[model samples]
Target: MSTGRARRALWRWLPPWALDAGLVALAVLDAWINLYDEGTPLIWSCVALGSAALFLRRRFPLTVFLLTLPMTLFMDVAVAPITALYTLAASTRNRPLLAGCVLLNAAASTLAWPLSDGFAGDQTWTLIQFVYTLATATAPVLFGQLVQARHDVALQLVEVEEAREHERALHAQTVLARERAQLAREMHDVVSHQVSLIAVQAGALQVAAKDPDAREAARTIRTLSVNTLDELRHMVTLLRASGGKETELTPQPTLADLQQLIANSGIETTLTGGLPPGISTTAQRTVYRTVQEALTNVRKHAPGARAEVRLWHDAQHFGVTVTNTAPTRPSVALPSARHGLIGLGERAELLDGTLTAEPTPQGGYRTELRAPTRPA
Candidate 1:
């Protein structure tokens, strides 16, 4: 395997001009071996011109093939005419034209030079020679057509792979939009109703309470309720839109939300280090989600485990790491689609980052994300 690769590498190092020159040299050698004994000045000139015509075969395939025919008549030279015929066939898609060229090559090879000598020969012998020459001429044409077909099939395979990848991306986006719409319906039906009742009761208490502190507390509750309701409406609107062109999800979480997320995680977690300010919002969100998913998994899979969330930065990059100790108690099985880590990995890839999750030597699990500090 290594030897084959090394040979191919060496072949690639040769320039196009060098390969063409080598072919021309081979054609010249063929002419010399066939015509060196009894060639006239005209026949020698014909051979020379035919050999030189191979240089321009790639650019003018039909003209080059025609140039080689005179030498095929005067001298029995194989290299120049076969190479020209192969070039013409490979470069053209006109089957009728290629068929005509093959017949012309066969006729030239069978007939004797000076025209009259061919008719003077035995008719049966001439017919037999023509059949043999015709069969030989067809070999290069078939080979050239095979090469062309292989090239076209390769291009089509590349296009098919690209289309399949595009379809997969569209399917994933559709699934995500459907899930968001379902979540929006749940929040509107359940959470909105409960919050509305809280706001109404708080308003009534503010109006009826006698003590100032009690009334003030009721007023605060009503105010907070109103704000929460407003935020929920905005979120529901965004989700129901299904990411239309006119709207985008906004106010995404950042590093500032890390502490609150950990405190509410219901796990014994310690946060260490800090990220530098001025990082992109997308990067910040990726960091937040990595920690969130890691902690969630620890709570579900590693029962009674202690977790550590660490934020660190270097000269070129910054990210977060979440690690949890092994489970201290048996965990209850829960139904899960198991797509959370896959989603986080895809998100990190969009920001030119990487996510790695694996078990540690101490029987714990670790999830880490590393991203460029200034992504393009």
Candidate 2:
């Protein structure tokens, strides 16, 4: 049990308190070995003063060095405590102070060797003795400086890793947002074209039931259905192609496409105002989707009801309002994800714009979106 206790104590890294206690123990042992045989209280008192100085070594290093300087005159090995001065200088990151302390300890130890009692060496042997003493005394402080430099390097590496992780997370979020926007554009293109053809064919079929003068209109409906299916198949092919071919070098729909959208829906459209040229592509795409969704909802949910898409623009602002009237009792139920309005809200916020959707006073839905013409 005693051996195990000794092993555990030796294996542990010493805390500041433990290291200070060790320094005090070493000081006591040195005083007992070096001054007791001389039988003088003055030499013992100097050892006591030097040992007590260890308590303030971390707080005031220069003061500790000064107090230990007088001890070199009495004992040949008395300058050993000045090594702690260099250790403190390294810990505090004071390069000039550490170098000064090293030089002072070397000079004092060399001068005291020849003057002390029982000294019989010439200058050559004395010089050799002083160089060995200086190197041994300075080793602990050099080791301490190396430890401090390694610790600083480790902290810098941790900071760099954290910064890299933050950048990677930001890049992932940006890629996800771009993918979602691309999906929204593709969905708008596919659904809008198919539903437009269906509405046009149904409207033409209704008008041609009683007239012999309507064969051309019937043929137009059939042609539209076939063309819509062909376009849909081509869209599917585009989706499976390598390298996002659907997105690259393809003509994007803009405000000009709104008239085509309305004509294909069999809804008569009137243009009163022009859209601003300075609007960003993202905002224009969002505006196009909002108009497209609103018209599709009118056709599916209010079969005979007409829709009005109004775009109003000024110098610094633009606005869009899509409204439809109440349909008959036999109106069809529209398929909806209910996420359109929320998605519109998010898109408007990205452009620093605003959107509002509410029930119209005439018993239908009205969606209004507004944005700045210039980047804000």
Tens-digit lDDT track of model 1 for 312-348: 9998899999999998855544445556676677667
Residue 70's C-alpha lDDT in candidate 2? 50
Return the top candidate by TM-score.
1
Q: Give the TM-score of candidate 2.
A: 0.47
**Pairs of residues clashing in candidate 1:** none
Question: Cα deviation of 237 in candidate 1 (Å)?
Answer: 4.0
Count of clashing residue pairs in every prediction: 0, 0
State how far residue 373 of model 2 sits from its true place (Å): 11
Which pairs clash in model 2? none
